[model samples]
Target chain A: MSGAFISFQDATKDYGSVRVVENLNLDIARGEFVSLLGPSGSGKTTLLMMLAGFESVSGGTITLDGKVINDLPTYKRDMGVVFQNYALFPHMTVARNVAFPLEMRGEAKAVTAAKVKKALDMVQLGQLADRLPGQLSGGQQQRVALARALVFEPRVVLMDEPLGALDKQLREQMQLDIRELHHRLGLTVIFVTHDQDEALTMSDRIAIFNHGKIQQCAAPREVYDHPANRFVAEFIGETNLLDCKVSENAGETFSVTLDDGSVVAAHGLPGLVAGDRALLSLRPERIEILPAETDATATGQNRLAGEILDTIYQGDHLRVVIETAVGQIIARTDRKAQEWPVRARVMLTFRAADGWVIAP
Target chain B: MMAMSLFKSVYATLIVGFLVAPLLVVLPLAFTSGAFLTYPIPSYSFRWFSELVENTVWSRAILNSLLIAGSTTVVATLLGTLAALGLRARNLVLSSQIRTLFLLPMVVPAVVLGVGMQALFVRFGINSTYLSVIVAHSVIAIPFVVISVSGALGGIDRRVERAAESLGARPHKVFFLVTLPLAMPGVASGAALAFATSLDEVVLTLFVAGPNQRTLARQMFSTLRENISPAIASAAFVIIVGTILVALLLLLMRRRSA
Candidate 1:
């Protein structure tokens, strides 16, 4: 976000008349871990392919180190890319797979072997160097792919859903390993994934993409704390969106009136105006539900009176959905409240700051 | 269902026997001491095999067959592999039609192809040269190479090539270092098939090749009218054994590659 390393200047991609990626502009800083997070068909993978020189840029320029690379072939790009399927060569052993890039670069034989060994050791796959790619497990294959991509010490590494084929536990472990690698090596990584948790955990900044455009790009905490719009808020995590109309817009404070005539203060976007229809997005875990006897409905706090619709057990937390006069509001609380059940009367309470105002 | 399965088993066994019976009968007959292809062997002897090596005409015919078949294997493999690679292009115009045209030699009757090639080679004044027979056999062998190589190419995962390019390999290097190695099994099998097709070809050579360049198959066909020699049986034995060896080599290659 501060210093640009890899920048897309109005980059676009199209297939015939269908535009897969619109005019996109983003700056990836040096030594930063940036992720393109989106659903399938959102053009995130297309953008990565364009950067890797596999797809031609339809309308704009892509630059690395201040040099335009529009017509450069993939081999001349000098950037490493790990595919979603791992794509390990079935005919080659792990060591040869790692050495392929170095050999292509015409490195000395001794240097290539040493660097390959170091890279494999970095990924803890040193023992499997002599094994062919087909003989290794899925996780090991993924590690070999990583080793090959990193063996040449390229300036930037692009990974396209590299952990998508692994199981849940293995995926998370690989995510942490990648994050640690990024931290230790300080190499810029542009990761593309559909999983939100992966982006939140492994990225310094994440660009939330939808409809071939970026809705927001910021740090994980910044995106989680203040999403740019409804798409950003909903795509990043679970949230309860309530319809409301802006009632007051004073300095540093904006208030919105709920559909049921309940008014609450919210921190709206900078462009919000009085009397505009908007949504109050509140994270489920941010809202607290209490029994009818609690005396917590006070000023500076948004309050709602509703009956519990149903209670769901989520292993460590109890998710209670309340049917209020306006709409349903969900609250996730500690599982110790086992007594909360169906059709129980409850009071929903949240701070004014927890409700983020977003225009439709 | 049980009775139907039993019937299917018997039917399949009978078909296999029908196909394999002639091939087996030729081998034992080739070893017979008699001068004809009669049923029971009077005594097993190497007289025909000895005569096969000493006879000048038969030895020359064997050399011609080996030379033509070797050349045919080389020419067909290169051209057919190139055709298969070209067909992988997505933008090739009327590619399906082109693929069928490439395989037309396999569908057309051998006699028709032979007559057509005979006329064309005569018009070009290449009818009597060794080139005519080699090219004619190549026409028939190319389809097998194309079919086999294309099968191998199709089985390969295209993402592996993309991976190689991403690893900084140029297009040609990607083909040599990744694609060709993965498709070697198909290419080798195709070569074996082309060689076998060339060895067994008769009508095409008979129509195109002259008397001096007479191939083993053509000479063997003439032996029926000129003389009933068991040397033909010896040549048949040699061809059968050679083909089986090549097939076994192909199987071993596929297993090793896999």
Candidate 2:
């Protein structure tokens, strides 16, 4: 945090008397592609706007390169922003749009022309440089906007759900394109998006936001595998939560008693105790279904007896829902696995290390 | 449905005839060879048109009209555009009240405005001058500019301005480069309306202008009161044709921009 390229210290935003972003602190290192992932009205976009100087900070300080930038105007902030709708100038040609920033900086005409060509080439829009923004297709227009934003060579690039308007295929392609660009240029990018998969795929680290506060901020694998709390666990992906009472606390792991009187060991949070109610988050893919006659007592795995309730085919996998003693548990199996007929007796098993215990 | 369609056509034809009746009567009389303003047309000639061009008084009045209308258009457009920008401010208090105040001159009777302006200009010692007449014309013309510019500014996406700022354009540069270019259509049409408004002004001109500052409308009024000549009809023909030309030019401009 001491060498942070951008830092928000107790930042707060209020519209009139209603506070939207409350007492937030975050540090983004140089060249890090950090994403603020949240649903609508979660203050993610507000934080981006504040950093870009489009919106003023109501409380605390935002620093860039160790200097307070709370009062800096947008033009002086040396930041580039790509809006959701592209926001390309309708009157200007594609090349002119990319050259706008250089022109604003009073660059030499010959230099500006060459830089514009290079920027357009970077986005592969060189052939369409003469077309107006209105004449270009949506994807082409988006590329032109990207070229314009990156042409300025700003200190930071803030994207506000820039691909939200694109189709799924185009959005995916753009995600890859932006990630490659970030890596090639070593750009510090702060992306805001509500799509969890997009965040997981594109971000170096994702800050999960809820109710104007960060629920958790960590690497994608860490956040997905060991979510800090129930909200993050539920928000990040689908998980089967079992209500249980902690019967034994052993620092890194604990044993919890389920509603059906079955004791199962689970990974534990820091402050968990022996007599506290908790929820165990078990990912569906981690659970393996086997025949009722199979014996797994020697494997040191948590076991449950259940009957097949339903089997939903998911193209690549089969989502088998088993009516177990604790509750209905879901397990994913390869689509080519043996047919799991309804009402068939089965045994479900998962390793203790795979079950994460979270506070209610 | 057939009967409704017939009725609509009949109503439209009647309205068109009612609007064009005066022009039908006045246009032919512009070329009348007779001395009086009668519709029977004793003879058809370009005598009145020739007289309009040959007479010094008529030429001076036409020049004065052009000078005043041109000046009024420039002054009204500058002030009206600034007012529209101010009215577009976010969280602006009394926005509606201020807009209504800007538009008040449009609804107020011309005679009432003329009386007030005459008194005010006399007190300021600028009575019966070209400045007084142009100032009076711009007061009413500004509302047209304001309405048109405001509509254009309203249609603009605010994000485009933010886009410009993010690309290192300062506030003034953004206005001159991005905002102004996007709003040019409205400003162009506003300017045309302002010119047309100033050209058609007569009641205010009579109250504030001197004999030397007489405009075409003022001259036509005095000529009508003194001697009802066919030259007055020629002047009316000229004014109507000039207005149509301005409208055509505006249409061409809008088409190019679009």
- In terms of lDDT, the best-performing candidate is 2
Model 2 TM-score is 0.94
lDDT of 1 by residue, B25-133 (tens): 7778778888777777899999888887888998998999999999999999999999999998767999999999999999899999999999999999999799999
Error of 2 at A321 (Å): 4.1
TM-score of each: 0.96, 0.94
Native contact fraction per model: 0.76, 0.84
Candidate 2 docking classification: medium
Question: How does the DockQ of candidate 1 come out?
Answer: 0.80
TM-score of chain B of each: 0.95, 0.97
How many residue pairs clash (N, CA or C atoms closer than 3 angstroms) in each of the candidate models, in the order given? 0, 0
Name the lDDT value of residue B22 in candidate 2: 82
| Residue pairs with backbone overlap in model 2 | none
